[model samples]
Target: MSNGVDRTILTKEHASGTVDRDTDLETVLRNAGRLSPRDALRYLTPLISVLEGLHTSGQSHGSLSLDLLRVTKGDDGAPRLRLLKGRPRKPTLQDASPKAALAGRMLLYSSPEQIQGAEACEFDDMYALGHMAYTLLVGEPYWIEEVDRLGFMALCNSIIGGAPEPPSVRAMRRKSIRLPHDFDAWFVLITTRKHPDHFRDITDAGIALTSVLSNPDIRELSRSVQFKFNPNILESPSSAVPAAPENLRFTAVFTIVASISLAIAIVMLLRWTNAQESPKRDPSLQSTDGAPATSNPSSR
Candidate 1:
C-alpha cells in the first residue's frame, strides 16, 4: 500500500525490478511548463477517474495534491498517473494558529472549507483537482503570490476568503495561453461553494471542461455563479476600529458649530452696520431747552 511518503515504483516494462525513476506530478509540470488545454485534460482525466472511483467506493482523497501524485510512463510510452494511498490528517484551528508547527505548504492545494477546518469530503478533492487543472493550464498556482508575500496565515485567509481570478484571466496575465471565456464560467461552476451547483460528477466536470475548451460555440453556464469573498473570513476582529462614522460625526459637529458662529457673526455685523449708518442727532440742531428749538427763530 502506498503511504503519503515517496517510494520507488516498478513500471510494467521493469516489473522484474523496481524503477526509481518515477517523477512526481509537480516535477513533470515544472519540466513541461504550461500545457495546452487538451494536454492538461489528458493528464487530469486519469486523476479525475481515480477520484470518481474513490467517491463511488464511499471514500475520498482528503489530501489530494500535486506532490502526492506520481507520473510514470506506461508500456505504450504514454504518461500515467499514480496516486499515493494515504491522506494527511486535516488541520484544525489550533494547527493554523501562529504558534502551531504545521507548514503552510501542506495547505497550498486546500479547499476553502478545508482551510476553514471542515471535515474532509469529495468536494474537497474536487476542489483540489480544479486547482491542479488551473495550475497545469496557467503554469502557476493561483495563490503563489500570496504564499510568497504574506506567509501561511495570509495564504489560509486568502483561500478561505479570496476569490480566484478565472484561469482565462490568469492566462491573460501570464501572456502565454489564451483560453475561451466559457472556460471561466466552467471554472467557477466547479469551484463554487454550493455543492449542488457543481457538475453531476467528476466525469461530467471533465467532459464539460473538455467541451468548453474544444468548442467555442458551447453555451456558457446556465446561471451566473460568482464566488464572492467570504466576509466572515475577511472581516477584521477589531470591530470597534474607527471608520467613516467617527469622521462623519466630527464633520457634522464642526459644520453645526461653524454655521452657528457664522449666523451670530452675521447678526452682530448687521447690528454694527445699522448703528454706524444711523444719522446721529446734530448738536447745532438740538435746543438747549427741552421745548422745541424752532427753525422759525432762524427765519426771523
Candidate 2:
C-alpha cells in the first residue's frame, strides 16, 4: 500500500447508457425541487432498508446525507438509489476538534446525541433519515436558511436545542404539496431526544412515514381546503398562497343560516304542539277575544 496506508478497490458491473451515473441525490433534489410522496417513498424505502440491514449486522452509517447517495436510472426508466461506502470507522463526537465541528451541511442530518459527543448508532441514522425525508418533501433542509445565515456552528446549536419547523408547515410554502396532518408528528417522533421514543428501527419508521404520506385526507383537503399565508413566519412571501376567503365566508354564512332556520323550525313546532295540546275552553265561558274564561271576574 502507498504511504503505509491499506486501500481496497471496489468495482461493480458497468451501467448501461440509460443509467444516469453522473447524478447524485443532492443534485437531483436541487434540480427537481421537492419530490412527491410517491417518489419520496420510492427513494427512501430502499435507503431505509439498507440502513436496516446495516443495523441488523450491528453496524451503522455514521454519515448519511443526500450527497452520499447515488441515484441512477434503471433500464425500465425507474430511479435506483445506492448508498456509497464511507470510512470504516465512525467518527466520535468526543474528539470535539474543529474539523468535526465544521463538518458543514452534514450536521443538518445529524442527531442531537451525535452532536453532543455520543457514538453513532441506529437512532442517529433514523434521525438522519427523518431529515432526508423532510428534505425530499420540503425541497431543502429544515435548518438550511439558518445555516446559510449563521454558519455550521449555528446548525449544531439548533440541533442540540432548537426544534425544527414542522414538515407540514414548511411544505405549506409549496402550494402543490399537501402533507398529511400526522407527518409532523412522525418527524418529531423519529428525531426526538429519547431513543426509546423513536421507531423500533429504520424500517418501521419508513413504513409509518409512508403511511402518513399516503393518507387520503391530504388529497381530499387539498381539493377543498386553502391555507392562509403568514409572511412573518414563512420564508417566501411570494410563494405564500392565500386562503380562499370567499369559500370560507360562504361556509360561515351557510352555517349561520342553517342554525337560524333550525331554531325557527323548532320554535314553530313547539307553538303548534302547544296549540293542539291546550285544553279547549267552553264557548260560553271563553271571552270574545279568545281569552280564557275568568271565573274570578265577579269576585274581582
TM-score for each prediction? 0.66, 0.59
Off by over 4 Å in 1: 1-19, 75-78, 90-92, 97-102, 174-176, 216-219, 222-300
lDDT score of residue 287 within candidate 1: 78
Candidate 2: worst 10 consecutive residues by lDDT?
1-10
Q: What is the clash tally of candidate 2?
A: 0
Q: How do the residues 224-252 of candidate 2 rate in per-residue lDDT, one tens digit apiece? A: 32232222332344434444578788999
**What clash pairs does model 1 have?**
none
Candidate 2 off by > 4 Å: 1-20, 74-78, 87-102, 173-177, 216-300
lDDT of each: 0.66, 0.66
